[model samples]
Target: MNWETLIDEESLALLLPAEYSHFALPIKESLAVFLSRLPQSVQDRLVEEQLALPVDATLSERLGRLAHSCPVLQKLGQILARDQRIAQELRSELAKLESMPSTVPLHSIESILMQELGPLESKSIELLPPAIAEASVAVIIPFREKNKPQQPEGVFKILKPGIVQRLQLELDILTEVGSHLDSRLHDLGIPPLDYQDTFNQVRDKLRCELRLDEEQLHLARAARFFADQIDIAIPELFEHCTPRVTAMERLFGEKVTDHNFTLTTEKQNLAELVARAMIVQPILCKDEQALFHCDPHAGNLFSTNDGRLGILDWSLAGFLGAREREALVQVMLAAICLRPEKIATTLLSLDIRGQCDQALLKECVAIWLRRMREGHMPGLSWLTGLLDEAVKTARLSLSSDLLMFRKSLLTLLGVLSEIGANGFDLDQIVMCEFLRITVMEWPGRWLSSPNSRSFATRLSNLDIAETVLSSPLIAGRYWQAMWQDSIERYAVCANSR
Candidate 1:
C-alpha cells in the first residue's frame, strides 16, 4: 500500500499516544521511505488496491485483517504479542492473526493427499471429512487405516498447496520493508542489519515448516529424548507417513486453555511437569545437546487423558550449543540475584551486533530488575520490553537463536500464568533446577578429568580451616543445601506418586 493510505493519521495518533506523538513524523517518513523502495509499477498497483478498499475501518482492525491474510504478518503478530513496548490493546488486536486461519476446501486437501500418497495408498487411508485444525501454513485432518478397523486412527497434516509460493511473495514484501527501515531510520537506533538478519531467520524457519519429514523425525527424536520420563508423551507417527502427509496418533486430550484441572494440586503438578520438561531439561543437558521446543504456547500443549502433558507441533525446534546453554545459566543466575550489571553483560555478549551503549543497557536492566524484585513479577513481556528498549537505545542486534528463545520463554510463561498455581516463582524454579543440574554434572566432570586426582591431592594438603573460610567453600555449602532440598522434594513427589 502507498505510504499515505497506510499511515492512517488517526490510527497513528492512537498507536503512539499523545506523549509520543512527536515520533509520528519520523514513522510516516519511514513508511514513505519503505514505499519508495518498491518498483513503481508494484507501488502503483498496491496503492490503487488499497485505495479501493474501505477506509472507514480503524488502522488496528485493518492490520488485523491483513495479518489473517498473510503468513508474514501472522509471524510478526506472534512477536508483537510478547513485546511490552507495544500498546496492550494493539498487541491484543495483533494477536488475532494467530486465531483459526481460513481453511482449505476438503476437495483441495483430498487432492493433495492423492498426489502425495498416490491414488492406491491414498484410498488405503480413510481420510475423514473436514479439517480438525487450520493454521496459516497447514491443516490437520484425522484418518484411519482401512485395513485396521480395530486399531486407533491418526491425524494427517497436509500443507496447503501453494502456501510456500504465497509466503515467498509476502516475504519479499517484508524484506523490502525491512531494507527501507534499515536504511532510512538511522535515528531509531536499530543496527543497519538487524531487520535483514531477523527477516532472514524468519524465512529460514518458514522453509523448515515445509519439510514434514524433518518434523516427523523431530517428533521421534523428542519422544526418544524423554522416553524414560513418565510425565511426557509425543504423538506416535504411522509408518506410511510422508513429507506432505504425516499421519500421527491423535491425542485424546484438551488444550491447556480448554482443560480446567480445577484442583490446586492438579494445577501445581501440571505446572511442575511443564517446568521440568521444557526448562530444566534444555538448560541442564548441555552435554547431551537438548532438543528444545520453540513453541510451547497453550494451543500447542495438551493435558492428555492418561494424565501426562502431551506435546504437539514439533516443527519448530532449537538446539542449544554448549556456550549458549552456559550463558543461559549465567543469565538466570543474574536475574535471580537481581544483578543488573551481570544481566546486561551476559545479554550483550549474546548479541550478534558488535558494540552498544553499555551504560544505557545496564541502566534499563537495573530498572527492570528493581521492578521485578519489588513484586512486578518479571515475565516474557517484561524481559522483551527491557531488551527492546535496550536494543533501541544501544543499537545492538540479537542473534536469531536468542530471538526464538525469547519467544519460547514468553510462551512457556503464558502457559504457567494460565495454570494459576499459587506461589509459583519462575526464578526460584530455574535456580533449583540449575543447582540440581550442576550437582548431577559435577561428579561426572570430576571423574572424567585427568587432573582431578592431582587437584584433590593439592586441596587435601591445604589448611582445612582456611579452605572452609574461602568463598568457593561457602558457595559449595549453599549449593549442597539446595541439592539436599531438591532431593527431599523429589522423594516427597515420588512417595505421593
Candidate 2:
C-alpha cells in the first residue's frame, strides 16, 4: 500500500490513452497537489492501484483490460457504457464490459460455499463444471439437488472472495474523491450535486448488490409485485444461503445478450416483451409493491423457453412511494401534453436537496419539450437530460432514486440498442401504457383513496371523446415535426459517415 510503489509507470499507464502521454506531467502534478491535501490514512489506502497496463494501448483497450483486473473499474465501465453524457464513441467502447466477465477459480468458489453452507451441505450439492456466468460482483454456477443429476435444479451465486472488501475499499476512495470535489472544486462549474450524498447513495446500492441476503429479499419482493404479470419470471430463492452465497431456482433460458437469444421469438414480439418489462409496465403499475429493477442490463434479462421474460439478479431495485409515483405520473402526463409548466411543478414537488430557481426550471423544461417535439430524443432521455441541465444551470437539487430511475432507463435503452431495437417508439409505448393503466388499473386506486376527486383522479378521468376528436390534429402536427427531424438527423448521420 505504499504510495511510491503503487503510482509507478505501469500503474499510471491506464489513466489515459497513450497518445495523451505528453499531458502526464500536468496530471501527475495535479494528483500530487490533491494527494498532499488528503489525510495520510486516506493516501495510504489510495496507494493500492488495480490498473497495470502497457503504455501503447488505446483508451478503450486500457479500460477493457482494467475492467478485467478490477471489479470496481468494471462497474464504472458498465455505467459509462450507458451514460449518454459521455461521447457515444467512448460509451460504445466501454460497452464491451457489459458482456460476461471471466470467472474466479472453481476452488475459490467451493471454499466460499463450504464456509457458507457448512461442509456437509456443500458436498451434497453438485456444482456443474465451469461457471454458467460471471460478473463484477459474483460467479453464477448451476447446481443440482442431491442424487438428481438429470438437470441443474438451482444456481449458486457465489461472491468472489474479497469482493465485498474490495468494493468497500473502492467506496471509501470514491467517498474521499466526492468529498474532495465538493469541498475544493466548488468553483469548477460542476453540476449542483452534493457528491458526498450521491456517493453515499451509490455506496448503499453497491452494498446491497454485494449482499446475497439482500438480493434474495429483492427477488421475493419483486416476484410478489409482478405476480399477476404472466409474461415475467422471477427465479425463486432457496432458503439455504448466506450473506455472500445464494441458492436460487435455475431459470432455463438464454440471456438477451446471447447471439441466438433473438431466435427464441420473433424480433417484434421480443421487442414488445422487453419494452413491457423494462419500460411500460414498471411505470404504470399502481400496486404498492411495484419496484424498478435499477439495473436491466442485458446480462440480467433473459428470453425464456416459454416465450416469457426472465428477470435475474434483483440487487438494486428501487421503490417509489405513492407521492413519488403520482409525481412521476404527472411528469409523464405533462411531457405527453407538452405542458412544461406542469413538468416543472411536478419535478419541484419531489425531493430537492438544494435551492433552485423555479423560473429557470420551467424555461429549461419548455426548451426540452420543444426538442422532444422535434424528435431529437426519447422521452426518458429528454426528461433526465432536462433535469440534469437544470441541475447544472439552475443549481436544482434532485432525488437519488430519480437519478437511479434515469440510469435504469438509459441502461435499458443501451441494451436494446445492441440488437438494433433502439428505434422502438418510446412515445407510443408510454402513451399506450398510460391509457391502459388509466382504464384498467387507476380506477381501483382512485376509489380506495380518501380523496377520490384528487387532481390525479381527475386527470385520469379526462374525456376520451375529446382526446379522440383531437387525435387527428395532434397526430398531424407530431408526424410533420418528426419527419423534418428525421431528415435532419439523417443528413447529420450521412455527413458524419
Candidate 3:
C-alpha cells in the first residue's frame, strides 16, 4: 500500500477540520519527507500501487478502507470506534473494522500453521475449511484434533502474512508524523502535548501485540489470577503454539454487544460480570502486579453459553504495580467519599516531578466531584475526565500505565453502554469490591502485625487498614449527602405540587 499517496493532501485535508486547515500542509510535507527516506525498491512499489488503489467517496469511507489496508490504522480505528467523543458517522464507519472480512486466503493460513507447527497431519490436527474469524493483525482458523476427541475444538490464531513488515512500516510513519507534530505544535495552534512521547508509548504497545509468546505468558498469569472465579473463562493453551500462531480452546458464544437477552435482568447481570471481569477484579487483585486486558472491545469479549464471561485476545495488556494499584484505590476511595481535597493530594503525589498547581488540581477534582454528585457515574469517564482536566489545568504528568488503563476503561465503558450496562453505578461497584476485599482479608491482616509482613504484604495490609479506618467516615458522609439530596428532591416535589 502507498501510504504516502493514500494519505495525500486531499486525504489529510479531509481528516482535519476546516479550522485546522493551516496544520495540514506541514503534516503533508512531513509525511512526504518520511516517505522519501524509504528504500528505492519500497518507494517504487508504493508508486506502482498508487494507480491500482480504489477511491472512496466520503472521508469515513476512505478512512475505513485505509484502516483495512493498514493494520496499525485499523487498531487506531478500533480504539476510536469505541470512543463516544468521535463523530457518530466516523465511529460507525470505523466500527466495521472490528469484524474485518478475512482477506487472507485459507491456503495462506494453512501454510502458516504448517510452517509454525509443522504438518497438521503429524499433530493429528485437521484444519477446518474457511476461517472462523479475522481481526486487524490475525486470522483465526478452527481445527479439531483427531486423537483428542474428548477435548473441545481449538482455534489457531495466525498472524497475517507480511503483517510484520506492513505494521512496522505504518508504525514508523506514525512515529515520523508524531515527531513532526511535536516540533510544530505552536504553528498548528494546538496546546503542547508530548506527541513524540505519546507515539513512542503507542508504538511500544502495538509492538507488544506482535508477540504471541508474551500474550501466552499473560494468559497463563491471568488464568492463575482468576483460577477460582467460576463466572470467568480463560481459554486453555494448547501444546501446538508459536510466536506467529497460538492454539487455544475455542469458546462458543455471541459478542457481549450482540447477545440477545429476553430479560433486562440478564443484561444487567452480564453487565456486572463484564464490570467485575474487566474493572473491579483487576483493580482489587491481591497479586503484586494486576494484569488488565488492554483491549476490551466487543470483538475480543464473548458471552459464553455456560454463563461465563469469556475474555479473549491477551496480546495487549497493562500491568499495575503495587504502588500504582494502591494509589488507584486511594483515588477511588476519595472519589466515593466526595473528598476532592484528598483526590487532589493523591493525584499530586503521583506527579513525581511535583510541578502541578495544587489549587488548580483541587479545582479540577472539585469539578469532577460536582459531576458525580449531579448523577454522572464515576466510572472510567469520570476518572479519565479528572485526569485530563488535571493535565490541562495543572500541567500534571500521569504515568503511561494509567493512561493505558484509562484507554482500556474507556473501551470497556463503551462496551458496557452497548450492552445497557452504562446505568450501573460503578462508584458503588468499586466501593463494594473494595469492602469485599477488605472484609475477606481482615482476619489475616488482624492476626499479623504490619512489621512482620513482607513488603508486598505490608502494602496489602496498609490498603486494608486505610479501608477499614475510612469506611465508617465515608459511610457517614455518603448518608449525609444522600439525605441532603433527598431533602432537595422533596422540596422540589413540594414546590411542584
Weakest lDDT window of 10 consecutive positions for candidate 1: 453-462
Q: What is the lDDT of residue 164 in candidate 3?
A: 86
Per-residue accuracy of model 2 over 209-262 as CA lDDT, tens digit each: 787788888888888877888998999887568788888888887766453544
Report the lDDT tens digits of candidate 3 across residue range 1-497.
33455555665565555655666677566556556655577667555554455544565666566556557768877877866555567778888877766778888888888888888899899988778778878888888999999989999888889878867776777777778877877776654556676777788888877899888998898899789999999999988888998999999997898888878888889988898889887777767788898888888889999889999999998887777766655676678767777888888877855667888788788677767878886764577688888876786876777778888887887788778754676667766876676576667766766633323222456555666787779767767777877797899999999
What residue pairs clash in candidate 2, if any at all? none
TM-score of each: 0.74, 0.76, 0.80
Where model 3 places Cα greater than 4 Å from the true spot, the runs are 1-56, 332-345, 352-381, 448-497
Better of 2 and 3 by TM-score: 3
The numbered model that scores best in lDDT is 3
lDDT at 222, model 3: 83
Predicted candidate 1 versus true structure: per-residue lDDT over 1-497, tens digit per residue: 44665776656656765666656655565556545555576567655555666867666665565555556556656545434454666766765544364378888988988787877364577777668777667788888888888768788888888887766666666666666666766575434445666666766766676778889989998988888898898998786678876889888887765567688888887888888788767766644356888767665778898988898888778776666655544554456544557788877787776767788777777667656644666543455667766766765677666667667876677667667677777767765775565455555554554332122111112222333345455455446645665686799999999
lDDT of 3 at 74: 81
Query: lDDT of each prediction vs. the true structure?
Result: 0.67, 0.66, 0.76
